[model samples]
Target: MFDQNFIENPYPTYRALREAGSAHWNGDFLGGAWLLPRHADIAPVLRDARLSAQRSHCYSALLPEPVQPAFAEFNRVFGMWLLFQDAPEHTLLRKLMNKGFAPQVTDLWRDAITRTAHTLIDRLPAHGTVDYMGSFAHPFPALVICELMGVDARDQAEFIEWSDAIARFFGNPASSLEVAYRGRDSLLAMTRYFEAVVEQRRHAPGDDLISLLIRIEEDEEALNGEQVASQCSMLMFGGHETTRNLLGNGMLALLRHPDQMQALRDDRSRIPNAVREMLRYDSPVQYLTRIAAEDFEYAGAQIRRGQMVVPLIASGNRDETRHADADRFDIGRADTAHFAFGHGPHVCIGTRLALLEAEIAFDALLARCPHIAAVDTRPEWLANFGFRGLSTLRLDMQTQPADAGAVAA
Candidate 1:
């Protein structure tokens, strides 16, 4: 599964896994784990309190005996992330963090998100090949998250570097010790950067997420300084990495299926549904890891405690039992149920925000670049199993920004 072929397309492997059995124990993945490829089994595991999200311990355990101590900080910081926490702590942190991520708050950024997308699209070459991932996909979400966090625009490049390093490590289950080192360094750098920003926000609060977190700490006394900074790091990495991949993957899917692209262009209302299909067709997040909280019977297999269980989200999204014509990519498809953002307690809190960003991004791209096509038929996918996305997407775009009269209309 770590080969180039699987990286380019893992759905076939997922199908095989699902057909072979309900769950297959693979000894190679993250030091032996059970892979759940079917939706029926994965859905319940996500909501089951018996499965724990605290899988940071596995990181150090995967490292060499000599270098294990180097990853202590990495384990500590990652364990603090909202994505890796369970009830009680997870519940309280989510409630306090909700003040900044609620739909109402997300709606406030519609104009900003739209404007950012258009700005990036406008910079693309009118009649030549360009890498959309660099010009737009990667930076669009990075800039929006930066604006949300009140970070200086000049710091965007460094932030992106930090994000990429952390994402590359976490998203690759077969990552090397070298990758672990880079991830640890980047994580620490980002945490320190956010810690400084948090101090500044403390002295002078603004309307951004940092300020909101500081307020949550002060008013409720729920979060310490380190915890506040940890959330900032998590949000910064999560907010940018997943959304960037979605834009890239969605664009590639549209380029591959012209009819679906035309459907979206024909009726702008379909953009939302189109976004959902894009998610299902090629999810940015391929799977999620959980530790068995207790011994339990699942799919006729007895799972021991402290064992790693992986829910293949991308596979479940393509499950024929749950979705009609699951393999097909149709923008107009009515069914939007998917585990792209996950399910149950650990479901992505930025679901609405991610959808909104993709919607605005596609709308702006189609509106401005009436003619868009991939430069190469063979796509280049990032060498990662856990995170499915393109490494680079070159495209030919003919720009035609809407006229002033049309905008007014």
Candidate 2:
């Protein structure tokens, strides 16, 4: 299943997995893990207390025992991430982090996000084919997250590089040791980069997430400087990586389903629903991993402690039992229940920010580009099963006049 065909479209494989049994053990997947395919099974497993969020051990098992110690920095940074924590630790860190990501705080950046979207859109060619991934999808969120994190917008290239390396290793279960080494280097580089930024913010604070984290650290003494920096690296990665894919994947969906695209263009209010459907239809985040905290029977499969549990979020989104016409992409569907951003405590903390960014992005794109068509109807997908996204999406667009559209990019 780790072939190009599966990478291009894993849904058929997901359907087969879901239909065949409740769970299947794949020895090659992260050195052996139980794959949970259905929504009913995944939903509860995500919330199950027996399924621990601490999967660093599972990650370490990917490398040879002797080489594992070389990834100490990788494990250190991963430990600081709230996604890999469970129970009281996860609860406390999430609460502390929430202060910075509060709705009111996130709302303060609407103007910045809008401006970034338009600035990137403005750079697009007037009447020619362009790779949306490079032109808009990738850089748009990178810049936004940079602004919010108090990092230099010019440093986005390095940021994307570091995140991509780590993602490539983390997302693909079949990653090589060489890929693991690259991911380790990237993670360490990013952590060191943020260490300096965090130090600067300590002396001279700014109205950004880093400064906010520092404030939380000072007030509560819950996190140290290094931990704060680690969170910054995590946030930077979480902030853009998935959102970038969402923009690309969502736009590709619209380009494929002209009727749905027209529906949103006709009524801008449907943009929100359209975003939801886009997430459900082709989720950017495809899978989430967990370590079985204890032995238990789930979906008729006997799960053993220390075993990795892989929940296919993309598969769960398309589960027929929960969603009617599960395979179809309809923006107006009412039953949009999905694990796109995941479910339960470990759900993506960047969900609200991501949704707002997508909403603003689609709104601005539809308003500015009156006529848009896919340059390559069958675009190639990245060989990444976990973070499902197009490698590149070339679009032929008829951009509106600079002075047109009251939407004000």
Candidate 3:
């Protein structure tokens, strides 16, 4: 079941698993983690204090003997990532990060997000097929986050490559030693780059997030250079990688359901809900790993201490108990409650920003290109199990007749 074909569309397998029980001991992946497949099971596990979010302990057991040494750098850097830390550490980091990541601060980027979306759309071919993922989805969020971080625009391409490598390290458990080394190298380079950024900000601060991290304080606690660099790297990864997938997956979902797409196009007010539905129907992050902080019984299974408990967020989103016609991609679905952005204390900090980007992106695409359809019905899916995204989404687009105010710059 851990094969590539299953990864492409694991819903059938998930449904079968869900029918069997809420949780199952799946020895196939993660060296035998307890797989939680239902909304009831997965939702509570997310908030369960007995589960540790620190995944390095779990990953260490999964690493092969030969790859163990090569995985050291990845473990060190990713260990510092906010997603992998638990308790007081996570609390402190989140509190400090929130100063600059507050909703109001993200709202300040709405105009910039809108402008970026339009600029990307403008560059799209007017009446020809184009790879949406390449032309728009991938770069839009990357550029936005880079601009927010005050990173050099000339290095945006390199940043994207580094981000992809790091994502592969986290999402692909079966990655070979060479792959792991590549991911570590990319992370090392990113760490050094951010370290310089942090040092520069320390001496000569600016208005970007890196500068904010350097100066932001919570009582006597403050982030050091390395912590700042790690946070910056985490933010850059989360800021773009998942959002890019959201745009691609959301667009593909709309294309698959034209009626719903037309409904959203006609009433832009529904774009927000549509985005929510898109997340629920096809979550960007498929699963999240949590270690058993202590031995505990959950969903009729005996979970031992230090064991990995993987909540299949994608499975939970599609559980029939959670939503009527859970499998259908209905943009107007009222129940948008989903584990897509995750749950509990570890929920995504950039949730609002990602949603705003998608809202603006879909609004712009639908408004500008009235006639757009997928070139291939079965679009290729990214191979990673944790992150669900399209590798390439080709769309044949036709521009709408120009309005009185619509004039090329």
Model 2, 1-409: lDDT tens digits are 8898988788899999999988999988898899999888988999999998888656666788898888776887877788888988888888888888889988888888888888888888889998889899988888999998979999999999998888888788867898888888888899999999989998999888888888884245567789888888888888878999999989988888899999889999998888999999899998999988889998888899988899998999999998988999998998777799889998888888999999999988998899899988689788787898887988888776444445443
Off by over 4 Å in 1: 217-219, 402-409
Residue 281 miss distance in model 1 (angstroms): 1.1
What lDDT score is found at residue 286 in candidate 2? 87
lDDT of 1 by residue, 272-323 (tens): 9899999998999999999998999897678899888999999999999999
> What C-alpha lDDT do the candidate models reach, one value each?
0.86, 0.87, 0.85
Which residue pairs collide in model 2, if any? none
Residue 208 local lDDT, model 3: 84
lDDT (tens digit, per residue) of candidate 3 on 1-409: 8787776788998899999997888786777789999999887889999999888644544667866776677688879988888898999999998888788788888877777777788788779999999999999999898888898877889989998887777787567666667778888899889999898888898888889888889899999999999988888888878999999989988888889888987898899999999899899998999889899999999999988899999999999998999999988787889999999999998888888889888877877888889999789988888888988999899765433242221
By summed lDDT, which 10 consecutive residues of candidate 2 come out lowest?
A: 400-409
Per-model TM against the reference: 0.97, 0.97, 0.96
User: Cα lDDT for residue 30, model 2?
Assistant: 90
Q: Model 3 TM-score?
A: 0.96
